[model samples]
Target: MTRFAQAVAESTRSVPVPRRPDTGRTRVTWRQRLGRDRVLVLVALPGIASLVLFHYLPLLGNVIAFKDYVPYIGILESEWVGLANFAVIVNGDPLFLNALGNTVIITLLQVLVVFPAPIALALLLNSLMSERIKRVVQSVLYLPHFLSWVIVVAIFQYMLGDAGLLNNFMRDYDLGTVSIIGNPEAFKALVTGQVLWKDAGWATILFLAALARIDNTLYEASAVDGAGRARQLWHVTLPGLRSLIILLLILRLGDSLSVGFEQIVLQRETYGADAAEVLDTYVYYNGILAGEWGSSAAVGMVKGLVGLLLVLGANKLAHRFGERGIYQS
Candidate 1:
């Protein structure tokens, strides 16, 4: 016991003590940090400039919502109308109500069907044993995302219009022509289908990335335990993707009101306003085309406020469910 205590004392004496860090050290100034990271700051300037020019600057235009904005007159000279422009919404104008209803229907369809389509595609692609076949399928699916709305609409019209490919084939077989393109009854379904075709594959990129991040050991361990593919997927794969899915869902809710202005507007005339009109197109036709700028701006402001509320509510719900959501808040 005496020798052991002597040995311990010797070892303790030989070891050096760690010095305390200086809590009183001067803090690094912003200018010093900027100088140290000058190269990175230079690299980020273009993106910062773009945000200021395209995003921040345009927020000033929302002021037009409260003004009787006439492009001929300067903003300073335009008459301030306050909430007068919002009277259409309060009074329940038929055109505005129709646009709102159509927007809601389309948004619901997209959330129910289009949102999950990419995840399903990603799972199927991941299950493929052959890499070449998987790449070919992915390439084919992703091709439509590169096509413009004009080309997408044109392609759909060529394939499904009254006198187009389907109708032509049916005519030869003595089958009656089906009205798809200019049919108001099928317009919502048609547009939703078009959105799915154009974007589903591109959206799959996120799920595929999330899948790639999942550890292979989990699958291997599950296999060793005699767990089937279904069990492994349920236990391992979905848990890995849950966070990303939640994040995307929150973001989707934020932009739920915006359902593609250019795409819907192109078909609105053919299907009539009742079928294809959405909040975005409503704002464009009334504000820019018809020169009801204040009212249009008011509608836009309302849409933005609603989307903001949705994001905040969703983020709070995510917090309650023990998820990070889009931000800490």
Candidate 2:
């Protein structure tokens, strides 16, 4: 070997060689991952069991929709009746239709009017400079969320019932008493108000969290650019919250058919089924109370399918608008 060949050999030896990437390495098995994170897996077992036991297991009971279900005979022993029960819904039982109408009306009111309330409230609360005052206000607002539907209904009755607080005050002053509690025309509005008052503050928690996540630098930049408060909100705040808003809206659509069962059931006696009945109450009355189990199950199954479709459609629309929505595509 010449000097030049020796120099080249030395130079090659001095240079570091890159190892090949481990493209052929086996991926970690789920079992291995679970073993490594056994603590987390153990912690999650209760929730997993609950979901399987409560949610997934009960889905099998939907078979009752196709059966002439009898409590004594049990689900397995019931005679299958294909789509006969669904004909009752299609043929338009007056009671079921009335309940469905009430449900749609209430859902629309909640979606259109009540839905934006928490966002507005959160924005207001977020803008407040006094943390102490905001915390106090938030506590007062959140208190109603902890109250049971029964308690909330009773509170409304006490305040709005004939000869209740408002009526009593009006009577004392010789003013005409207002009758709102059992008014059919006002039922939708009443429920909307009740939902807003009871849960709106609790709903604000998510919006507040989303608001908190918004980069303060964006606001600072907007301020430096001479944007007014309104401009900043419109430009920076709303954009930052767009994804969360879409996600919650999609979830709301998924649950559009489920206007509070307990709330409506509690008020049904006062307002009658005409005004207060919804799909859930209808199921309770027809299935549990009247023993028309098959028909009720059929109606419920349809409601669930509709809710599923609504969620899918809403998510699709969200994707069209460049949002990831509740789940990624």
Candidate 3:
């Protein structure tokens, strides 16, 4: 072999080999993850504990619905009574029936009338150019949400009670007094109005956040296409809010049966059980007050089951229309 050929071969052999980069992600073990994020895990422990204690732990007590629950006998020792407790509801106990009817009425009224109020209020607030005025209005509206049901009910009683502000004003003008507070006929309307006044502003916070997330370019583009404010809102704003609205609607339907325990309980005595009774109040009165634990548990279990079905049904409908509901299908 020639010396030049040997030299060329040797040079080629000395050329560096390209190395593959170590870019692969290492799999994390659960233990390692727990250790690495120990602080965060510790922070979340209270919430996890709360759910286990207040939510999941109570699920075990639901078996009392199928048993003749005697406090002395305790939960596990309670004699199994099959479906006897539920038969009270199915066989039409007058008190249970009255409570169920009132619950349905109040739930429907709140869902249909009060539910849409927040979205409308958010839209109205969004339309205002002045941030200061909007904030002031929001502060005023949101204040009521922080107030307890007791306080809200008290305020309503002061303003609308037979001998309160409204009646006092009527008397001064020699006008006839209106019977509003404790009036059975207007109980549903009063409850719905109270809910609106208390929570509508707070509910608007979610809607307003959704509104803020809507791209401004869409609004500008709509305007460029000669669309007016109404048209822009119809085409751009509503579509942007469609998902959030549907999600909230599904959630609301799930919770429709849970009208208001505190509010209803406070009013039940004044209005009489026949007038203001709802499922929650009925459960409380029967379980805690009357010691009919099994029957109350049965009613509560049925309510929860119905709520679950409503959420699932609504989510299914949402998916059928090619939209993501509460979760992915």
Instruction: Report the lDDT tens digits of candidate 2 across residue range 38-98.
Output: 9998999999999999999999999999999998989999999998889779999999999
The lDDT for every candidate, in the order shown, is: 0.94, 0.93, 0.93
Cα miss at 275, model 2 (Å)? 0.9
For residue 11, give model 2's deviation from the true position in Å. Answer: 27
Model 1 spans with C-alpha error above 4 angstroms: 1-28
Writing each residue's lDDT as its tens digit, candidate 1 over 92-172 gives 989999999999999999999999999999999999999999999999999999999999999999999987999999999
Per-candidate TM-scores read 0.90, 0.91, 0.91
lDDT value, residue 259 of candidate 2: 94
**Top of the candidates by lDDT:** 1
CA RMSD of each candidate after superposition: 6.4, 5.2, 5.6
Residue pairs in clash, model 1: none
Rank order by TM-score, top first?
2, 3, 1
Please write out the lDDT profile of model 3 over residues 124-238, one tens digit for every residue: 9998999999999999999999999999999999999987999999999999899989889989999999999999999999999999999999989989999999899899999
Model 1 TM-score (2 dp): 0.90
